[model samples]
Target: MTAPVAKLLLKVFTYRQLAVGGGFLAGFGYVYCGIGFALSALPGYIILEDHFQDQFPKALSASSLFNFIGIAVLPPLLQYLKTLFGSREAFILFGAVTWHMIPAGFGLRDAVPRGGCIDRPSVSKRHAKTKRDLKFVNKYLSFCSCLFYHKNYAILVVTEFLSSLIYISWALFLVSLGTSAGLREESAVILSTAAGVGSFLGTALAIGLFHFQKMNAYTSCAVPLLVNGIGLVGLTFARDFNSLLSLTLLTGFCLGVNISGMIGIIPSLVCRYHFQQAVVINYFIDGIAYQFGGLISGAIRDLYGSTLYVYGFAALLSFVALPWILIWACNKDPNRECEPDLS
Candidate 1:
């Protein structure tokens, strides 16, 4: 991390992430649930870059607003229907009946496809059409690269890259870290579940932390980085499952805190118009970073036993982001009132 990045973390990164997280969970639901069915699910979430907010507030706000509305309305709406109908049985029965009837009604109204003469053109003409469509989309998407040059954009870009690199290794290694210490698969699952429980707890803690000081995004990230590092480093010497699980919870808590703060922070820093672009870019960075990590972890693990070096390397990469955040904070004026919506 460079000095400005470090400084920025303390002053700006926290609120930025908080802003982004609000929309990220809701807008990103498709990624979470859809991908779960398609791929082996990971117990995790996504973090957008902090700088994207600087350029895309309107888009971000719209996304976040809908999410806020959904969270507020969904539970109550379901409960209201249940109560109004006087029982869960009636509520569900009606819903099931509607599901079948609505589709059946549509089916009843459907006009079946009527055969027509082939509209297929020659191979050369078809190839031309495909080429034109690809060129059009690629040209439009290239406009998104404007975000790449801004310093704020770069900071987010790097953090995501580093976070992904670190997370990929940490997640898989966590299993072995427990099992090697005599944890059975069930125990490991329970321990992972414990960490999941701690995730919500960590979010609660972030609320209090925010109340104590403004933003504090970088410091919030730093705290978790240090805690997770210490825990994993300790694991190199730990001989039992309970200790491993305890450390796992500690790390999970830190992760939970990190994600919550990050979501809250990103939108605060960017303009609403750029929100969609920023989100897309953030994911691109994360994807590239994780691709590198997968190869690195396998190579290291294959070359050596479960050792301190691999974990240490991951910790060290996280540390790389700290200085940039700190340096970012140092250059900013100390006494300005914060912009709204960042908290």
Candidate 2:
């Protein structure tokens, strides 16, 4: 009787998690899908960039913005959505895809100029069962990585750990570079714009080049990190701040390409359909990445007393990320199929 009761408790715990995690994922996925749906418009990013800048006092630090992303924004968004539409993750996913395609179709037809307002179609029903529909069409956004299981996910996650470290280090270095080079605040703003443009173009190129390639996600990620490392190294030799900014444009753009490519690895890199759990696992690792990156970058900046050396240090650390990149990008994991949740 005790054995049976213990098993019963274990089963209850699992079901409880299914209720909570699944519900959390659903609400979060919904808002995310809604945002994605609207952003399918090409002009959406520019509009957002401007809108965000308009809300601030002027050129607040990027770190501060990230703090907002972590603290104020993401938590509330997750909670509110979970409450408002917890049971309706599938519907949210559908709405997101619909919004994405509708705007895209209009753009193709030249029916509306990019960014023109099209009325949003209303949600026709709201009598949702208030529970996660795990089998909902949201699987289209599921992580489907071949590497995420077996030993490969371990390898790839390790590689991302190192690479993300260097990636963030470079971002931190840029502010110091701007101030030390005596570039006006306005010039720094312009440099950011240039970097954004370059990043967008680079990602576009990756998409075009890898359009038909298998495991393009992995290849796409590796190519950009290699390029970004090279670019950051070159930044050390930049003659002036403007020159530094110019060099950084190349690096930033290359990084932009890799960022999405890295994210695209989620399901394929994780072992199963539990992609959200896998990704949340990464978020845990990434916390250390940010904390340590900032601590080390700041420590070196103070010790070396040179922006050039600080940049060089960041570039060198990027090398540690290389082994992971080489292995994951080059190796084929035999494309194992994920077993469905049978229960």
After superposition on all C-alphas, the RMSD of every candidate to the true structure, in Å, is 20.3, 18.3
Q: What would the per-residue lDDT of candidate 1 be over residues 110-169, giving only the tens digit for each residue?
A: 233334432455534644554454464435554453243234544655665776787677
| Model 2 Cα lDDT, one tens digit per residue, 161-191 | 7667776777666655766677765454455
Query: Native-vs-model 2 lDDT?
Result: 0.54
Model 2 residue runs over 4 Å out of place are 1-148, 214-218, 340-343
Would you list the C-alpha lDDT of every candidate in the order shown?
A: 0.53, 0.54
TM-score of 2: 0.53
Worst 10 residues of 2 by lDDT: 122-131
Q: Estimate the TM-score of every prediction.
A: 0.54, 0.53
lDDT for model 1, on a 0 to 1 scale?
A: 0.53
Q: Pick the candidate with the highest TM-score.
A: 1
